[model samples]
Target: MSAWIEMISDEDADADLRAALDLARTPHGTVDNVMRVHSLRPNTMRGHVVLYRAALHDAANTLPTWLQETISSYVSLLNDCGYSLANHWKNARHLIGDDARADAIWAALEARAPERVFAGAELALMRYAEKLTLEPGRMVAADVQALKAAGLDDGAILEANQIVGYFNYVNRCLNGLGVSTAGDIVGYYAENEAE
Candidate 1:
């Protein structure tokens, strides 16, 4: 419930901000707390939603949605953003559809042994996300080479990089702003079940 930025309620938003909020609403008919925080600057929030949608949800994307969610969950875990971790892990579970595999992936990531639960392109992608999140400056061409070796093309690799980078940026925003997980997946599911 604690947010460094004041949470903007839909009812209290200015007309323009309401328009921006409309673009940011979740499936449960509530705007994300992250977006509510960003609503402090409607224009920036609009730009953020545009970039976010393009980066993560563009129709032309080649990477499978499950892999994208995997990268997001891993990056969030690496950054220790509980809000993003919980939501993205829920997404990964929904897309992946195996609770044990999802749990193993999270456990492996936590243990720094992703290879135990992932292999081939999946393992490579996980390693790449780890490097991109933890030591971007030290990244070398061999890292991309590993992804290529894992059967990813240049375009897919590029998309993976963007997804990893996006989560890092977003995780920082959520973590730094003290945004709680109050209205994330758990709450969304709870509300749906009650309805």
Candidate 2:
């Protein structure tokens, strides 16, 4: 499905917006529809690009990139956002490099029973993600304590928190705008997010 609103094209962008669009471009050199939704406000688009890169692609994140991709897919699934789910699932599959393993994880995520495939700190974080995504108001400090008890240090918990929050934000943006995987290349920007 196309966006519910009009999106600005590269031809219509000024120098500054053109720069922002450049950063958001897929490897195909075209802006993905989700990022294009922010074209009306160049600054917002730029912020999205920066946040996305840092949250999921930054080398400094202690969480493995594959795990981040899985977290993104999980959040999208919770939000019923096909665009982000399909895109990040593809990315996660490629990074995981084992079709069977990735499919098992996908199965668990699809079942909304992360415990089926995850354990320990990973399981705790997935549970936290579910609670935060589905019941933002019900969360309490006990959630953080649970993560800590599961062996996640404060830094890892924060990283997982940022990833969950980022995917929730992206999921709502795409869902609210009617973004879909129609013409976009699934996972095209996964490895090339730094541009």
Measured by lDDT, the strongest candidate is 2
Query: Residue 81 deviation, candidate 2, in Å?
Result: 0.5
**In model 2, which regions exceed 4 Å deviation?**
189-195
The Cα local distance difference test for each model comes to: 0.84, 0.88
25-126 per-residue lDDT for model 2 (tens digits): 876787888888888888999999999988887888998888888888899999999999889888888888899998899999999999998999889989
Model 1 lDDT per residue over 71-189, tens place = 88899989999888887777777777778877887789889789998899989999999999999999999999999999999999999999998899989999999998775554233
Candidate 1 Cα misplacement greater than 4 A, ranges: 185-195
Task: Give me the overall lDDT of model 1.
Answer: 0.84
What would the TM-scores of all predictions be?
A: 0.91, 0.92
Assess the local accuracy of residue 34 in candidate 2 as a C-alpha lDDT between 0 and 100.
82
Give the Cα error of residue 150 in candidate 2, in Å.
Answer: 1.3
